[model samples]
Target chain A: MLYTFSEVLEKVNNEVKDLKFERKPYSLFEPIEYILEIGGKRVRPVLATMAYNLYKADIEKTIPIALAIEIFHNFTLLHDDLMDRADKRRGKPTVHIKWNDNTAVLSGDAMLIEAYREIAKSPKEALPEILNLFTDTATEICCGQQLDMEFEQRLNVTTDEYLEMIRLKTAVLLACSLKCGAMAANAPESDADALYDFGINIGLAFQLMDDLLDVYGDPATFGKRIGGDILCNKKTYLQITALKSPETGKEMQDWINKEVFDEQEKIDAVTGLYNKLNLKGLSEEMIESYYQKGLSCLNKVQVDDNRKRELRNLAESLLTRKS
Target chain B: MLYTFSEVLEKVNNEVKDLKFERKPYSLFEPIEYILEIGGKRVRPVLATMAYNLYKADIEKTIPIALAIEIFHNFTLLHDDLMDRADKRRGKPTVHIKWNDNTAVLSGDAMLIEAYREIAKSPKEALPEILNLFTDTATEICCGQQLDMEFEQRLNVTTDEYLEMIRLKTAVLLACSLKCGAMAANAPESDADALYDFGINIGLAFQLMDDLLDVYGDPATFGKRIGGDILCNKKTYLQITALKSPETGKEMQDWINKEVFDEQEKIDAVTGLYNKLNLKGLSEEMIESYYQKGLSCLNKVQVDDNRKRELRNLAESLLTRKS
Candidate 1:
């Protein structure tokens, strides 16, 4: 009776589409609808739903959790976009741009409250654990964002620091989503812990893939301009690894230190240095290691292998995604 | 034994002082500590604790709820200050000014999560109801803020609309604080509902008193400069009411429409218009009406009159306070 990955994704999409925002003060709710409509992959909620389906056939129970995670994710994006001063997301103007910074701030706050409201709808017995996990994850994301901002000011951010930042900023929510789903289904503690571990590793590898694709992804397939991380001197895994190289470290620093240069030229130069240093291979090896570790954790979940097939498929697809 | 209002206030203040922010990254937690340390009345938590004390002698059990309401209130202020571009709160530079806008945004978010985490520590049986109330109130506050912002751009706001805005923005949290405490103490639902009513009326009156103080109070006694609302052309009840006056409505619009005027001169002229229109008397009548209504709600609470004494005193002090 378990749904496949795409089936759960469709369910989540429909639920998101069906979300009612009839509240007054339309300004507050309109931006919420706008951000939800201009959607991303819906990965967190789908993972949550799929994780819940692994333990129970009745997926209806997890709908609120799914919406909660999706809404919470979008809330973070709304505020983060404002903080990053990002103009567009999903090929449309971001909330702050579409509305205003104050709207983004207030709407994002409401979205977080809405997320809590949705999550609280879980079966009463499971509420406390799920709420605690979600809150802890939320706090960690804020810490991760702070670290990411701090890193932007310093030149010597190490690889470990970068990995830790991504772990908090990007990985923990993915892990929490799965754990919340498992808890909602009344899964055994051991199995839930294993699923959480699986999520963490997959999430780490997922972010590493994002870093790799920014420099090496095919421009046509990547869906964003290639080498954007380079032009911005973002402290990605590839960049951090390249900076550690004895052979090309100086050249990487020189490119980063350029006060004025053509954007494409800088991208080309730093990317060439990455190619010379074989950073692409190093990053791929790291990603493979994390992916393997993730699979090993999945092996410990104690579910029949067939029941895990969709989750495993989803993880593999994430590893190989082009855009 | 029930703790007196001042005793509960002391406990709440001590708990706030004892809050630790040892977590990294310090950048995120530091501003939270800063905002908390620059204290206000701690009114919401004190109200919660006092409401809980009305039924149960175990005020200790309400600490988490008290802290939750207090932290949530501070979180609102942090974001509200940023949204309003307010530079000072409690006579200190605001989070956005002392740190930066991004820090204010992220740190405010963290405070909110922290608030939920604390609230979840309530006795398990009471957690769900308290959380639901908190979340709804939080959403309403955001809606209220949106309305407030929207009103700033328009001049035709009605008095009823103005009342609704303050009820959402300022009053509900007070009401929620009381109801949460009542729920935590396992009071009869009737008494809890009555306390909420009392809170709403008192909160409305509290805000009206604030509006009255802004224009007519002794300048030396009012902590802020008198006539701040007038100078900013804020759409408070006083302004909205004056806009409705037939005799002086035209003059009121002129002052508001003026592109240039001496600040003191504008304050003086507006004060004169308000005097001629009897706005001060009208506003005081509204405040007295709400205060009386609040007392009647308090009268319905099943608790002994003795248990209600301190809460009544607090309301009286709030009504008469200049600053």
Candidate 2:
């Protein structure tokens, strides 16, 4: 399973690495290359390939769709950095930070178009379905981004709203990857839809765990600072769910409404309260429930038992991991 | 000529206003309507219709193609505003400023895809050809945008370099508009290619005139501040060509190097120097030269002389515009 995942990651990195030349002899391309090169876990593309392999082991055929997924993912990261005003991505300077906002936007635009071009490379008969899925996925991701922006200034947002936002913003693209890969491999529509469900469920679980880890995980091993979301006052799943907790709702609102506080003190207070509320455990349980549902979706697909076993095992490995 | 131009503008505006809602929710549709309402001249799309009218008078058939051009144009503007950190576009706040950077980028992304879908609406015989031209135009627009960015800080650019940049940035899409229109109307390939040259030349001429008007036009008529390019230190044709003159080179460099000056005073001084070097007249002469070349291209097309007269009259009208 590790080798299979690595195989998909390799192609994703390759496609993302060989972006168009940095025309005009400037270092603007550096930040773009920087964010893409600094490395992600390649989870989306891996799900695409693994999902395809669940029905058919055509790794070669699935590579391009996986590559498309990865490109689209990175493209989002580029623009999201601007929205987040994030200076660093993956421990490296972001596209907008390193280059001016203009270059960042242009390069991101180019990357997105390239993603579609890559997706359109599938065989003619296979293309319309995959293209339709890719188009729908892109729009869903946009809607997710819009919702994420809406979450920022809207204090009335509920946990369900946050969940939907994350699903659109993060999960749908991951699902599209799997769906595209299966469609490319000529899987039946039912199997492709099942794969989509499986990927989207995992993606939701993955984001849920991310919200948990941001507050509860060991910073050294987590590859991010504990409570980074609290530091930024980002509207994440844990924050929303914790705020939505009937008993804690009023107090949490008071904390969030405070305009001025010591930075570290705010982080400390938020982290302490989140832990006291058992939100981490709640997150863990909910994430596992989604994973179980995802596994059931996989099992329901009409594929060979061995293939199903491999997929079920892979999902377990991802869901149960700490890092 | 004015009647034809107004007729085209009105029809394009009406057709563009008539977008069918394939997706739910009005907010998703707002950006497109917002941009169209900002009231551009519909220059590219009109060029498309005019070019098609040259070979075939059934110009109604090209509406989808023309709308595709408009969509692509707005997509560029949306993303460009994000890149430029521009606050207002045509007296309204930019998409990024009004909504958020993520919405701007995503809306722009969706606009580009929708443009492709619209382009794909041509007859099947024209579909592949239009896609090819659209893709090529899309690539050129990116390259052109990259060059425009490159020109910002670049000091050694000559008139030829500036022309090349504008040709790609402003002209290619215009050329693509005409070419796509011709293809959609099933005009002869030679007529399409010739019309492409005409549109490209005319587009370049129009951008040059815009540069001229930026410094010289009445604020009310121009709908914005005069000398905006000078204020921004834009390396436009006037500035670049003025700098290219051996005598004005030193004076141009001085003004450019000046870190501080009163806005009106600085604009006056630069305008004075450009006048002294006759850069405006030079630009005027160059514009006329291209207009002639455009007309010459129009002449070479094998279409009936009477039908060709419509495009030629439009060119003449654009040549004589005051604002």
Candidate 3:
């Protein structure tokens, strides 16, 4: 029996909520509970399940793998929140802000271990491949984060470098999710590889859309302050592309170099420069290219088109998200 | 042919040095290199190799397991240094101090993934069991560290609580090391269990000895300042025991509550109280009890006495260590 995307999401959420975290060490487990409770889209697990259902309708066996990806995602966010010194996550105070840095660090470490415990629960035959893939993904994600940090300290980050960073930091995990689900279902190597590629392209397009929305999305719908990237001088795709354009590059650089500019004014000037350079149109074209590439990869999978409708819908929903 | 202890250490060192870490992200790997270079005793890996040799002389097959435990040990230290906000490790600046806290956190995370990478390299037959053991040990260590941190903020930590924390934080990894090596060797489960128990007891004794030396040993030999633990008011077994005693508990409480007390005066007073209570003797007795338990566990292992000589010697060296 094929399940809809919402059904798959509900199953994943139930499994997550049912996890019996110990309550003795309130400092460690409390923050974990807080983060997991204030959930995201559960996109990774949903993707994993949707990929599995396309081959094997038995979602029971894939829940651990799904949970593993979810836990690992939260673990990374816990640390990323600390590294970014973020005050809020999903509209609540971050683990570090609510507790302290040490609590955040140690709790995050435990959560990483918890992620592995879930990964290990995969059927023995699939364990080695999944573990290897997960390890590589984990290492690449770290590299991606390091690159992101490195970029933050630099004034001139190339578009190429930024894309690679996001690919590592964001796309590989999505790819790993699909590939892992396929592996759990004992899908053929070719199909699994195709799903991975499909995920990577979709992930890239999804991130590109996120960059675009941060600037142009309506404030009431986006659930975040507009032009935050511009205010922080974050070297996102639009910023990098605008800075790379010869016509407006110098002016954009001058705006970025201003030491004591008002925050709102800086956001306005940068957004204005972005508009003048028509970066939004360029970014849309780039996103569409990746979206098409992703669809091609999905088409290459041997599964019938009908079986892929849920995954396709998910990709579309993510790309079109206003928040 | 079976290798001696130093030979095993040298083999592990060569394998570690031969590992080709990426240099592009110097911030992540550089701190890892720096910490590994300022080496500890490599006790965990050496114990692992010795346990493997006791059953199977093919040390070649165990190199990856050895390296895995060593890397995991170093990874813990990297984060532990940051959590404790310690300035120096082994007479050199910590990763956080040398690079920064974020560097320490991310690099430690990468090293942990690297440890799993090494563990995955274990012979296929031993991989799952070793991974399960490693994961459990890793989680327990985190729990232990959390307990330690929690205890730091409280004044009424019990001796049993302190023992359990140290066992989790310190002993379990040692036990895991020996048990993993035995599993790799396909040693009898009974013998493997005995070796694990032996490691736990030895590890407890080792930590107890460390606490004793921190108060009584010569600074030159200890490689750290005497009375430093007392100065920081760390709730070691010594402090916990003294605080629990009816005869001196009141005086100990008063001394601990002194907000602006002179550091030297506090240290002198604490040392005087410990001497009055003969805590040094009580601690030595506790160490001997654990050491004896460890030896008894070793005796229970089915391996020939000659096959056990190196492990016995290593245990003795650790027990008698001044630093």
Candidate 4:
């Protein structure tokens, strides 16, 4: 009765599509519907659902929590896009651009509320725990985002600091999503903790892979300009490592301090320095370490290895994903 | 053993003061502490505590819910000030003015998560109902704000439409505050419903009085400058009524459409037209009606009259206060 990755993904998509934003104050609800409709991979909710499928066959009971995670993820994206002043998300105009800043702020707030309402629909016995976990995860994400913003202004950010920031900003919700699903299935507490740990490692690896793909992936497959992070001087793991290395630190700083430069030249220069440092090999090593650590945690779960197949495949796919 | 209104207010204030924002990423939490520190009347929490006091002697048990309401209210104000492009709140610089818009948005979001975290600390039996009530109320407030913003660009907003907007934007939180306290106290559902009704009516009256005072209160007592709303062409209850009136509609439109004029002259002319139309009297009647309706609902609560005294006093003070 275990749902495969695509099956869980389909289930999550169906639930999101079924949500009606037909409330009054169409301005507030329309953006929510718009963002939800212009969907991404549904990664968070699918993670939640697949995690649930690891322990229980009653996938129907997990839909609300799954949708909650998805909606919450979208809420964060909506606000983050506004904060970053980015013009697009998933290749479509962001809410602030589509409507206005006020609409983005208000609708984003409502979406957070909507996420909580969905979480509250959990079985009464599990509501309190799920609610607490979700809130704590949410708070961490905010702090993570704050740190990410703060790091943007500084040049001395360490690799550890960057990892911690991504952990808070990105990984914890992934952890929470997995743990919530396990909890909903009445999984043993130890098993749930194991799943949470699995999520954290995989999430860290997942984000690292994103950073890696931004620099190394083919443009036709990456779905974005490959040198975006480089052109913007984003302090990803590779950049942080390159900046910390004595061999490349001086040159990296010179490049970052440039008032203006040709975009391709800067990208090429940074890419060349990263190559000299063998940053690609190092980042891959880090990614592989976390990916293996995630597998170890998954191995500790009390569930049979067969039941863990889809989740295993997901982690593998994420590590190897080109886009 | 029921706590007095002042006692509850003191408790709520003390709890707010004691909340530590010492977590990492001080930039994210500092603004949260800053907004909470500047403070307000603590109305929502006080209402919650007093409502709890009516049914139980254990006011300590209600502190988490009370603080939750207070923090949530401040969070809304933080974002609202940003959206309104407001420079000041309560005679002090707002969070956005003090920090930045991104800070305001992120910190406001964090405050919301903080509120839910506090609410989760409520007695487990009451958590579900309170969380649902809170989520619903939060969504309504967002809708209310959206409508308020939408109404700004239109010239034909009806009295009912305006009332509905205020009810959603301003009144529901008040209602939710009272009901949450009652729920925490394990009040009977019927009694809780009555308290909610009382909150709604009084909240409507409270907002109406704010609109009235903006136009008619003594400058010495109103704290804020009178006719500021008029100067900005804010669509308050008085302006909406004036717009709907045959006697004053044309002149009001003339004044509203003028692109250039003295601020005081515009205020005076608007005040004169309001006087000629008796908007002051009409607004007062509307406030009085809501106040009476509130009292009637309070009367339906099964609590002894003696236990209702502080709440009754608070409501009366709200109706009569100039500022």
lDDT of 1 by residue, A174-279 (tens): 9999999999999999999999999999999999999999989988899989987898788898788778889888889888889999998998888888899888
The residue-level lDDT of candidate 3 at A64 comes to 90
Q: What are the lDDT scores of the predictions, listed in order?
A: 0.92, 0.78, 0.90, 0.92
Q: After superposition, how far is residue A166 of candidate 3 from its true place, in Å?
A: 0.5
On the 0 to 100 scale, the lDDT of residue A159 in model 4 is 91
For candidate 2, what is the DockQ? 0.36
Question: Which lDDT value does model 4 have at A314?
Answer: 93
Best model number under DockQ: 1
Question: Model 4 chain A, poorest ten-residue lDDT window?
Answer: A20-29
Q: What is the lDDT of residue B81 in candidate 3?
A: 89
With a 3 Å backbone cut-off (N, CA, C), the pairs that clash in candidate 4 are: none
- In terms of docking quality, how is candidate 4 classified? high
All models, DockQ values?
0.93, 0.36, 0.77, 0.91
Candidate 1 chain B — worst ten consecutive residues by lDDT sum?
B235-244
- The per-residue C-alpha lDDT of model 3 at residue A262 equals 87
Provide the lDDT at B18 for model 3.
74
Give all TM-scores, in the order shown.
0.99, 0.88, 0.97, 0.99
Residue range B1-323, candidate 2, lDDT tens digits: 22276688788989987875456334655786788778787878888887776656677878989998999899998887777778999999999888877678777877887776676566566765686678767767777787877778778998888898888888899889988888887888898999899989998898898889999787877777899889888878889877878878888888888988899998999999888988888889999999999989888888768767667777777767767
* lDDT (tens digit, per residue) of candidate 2 on A260-298: 878778778887777778877888889989998898877
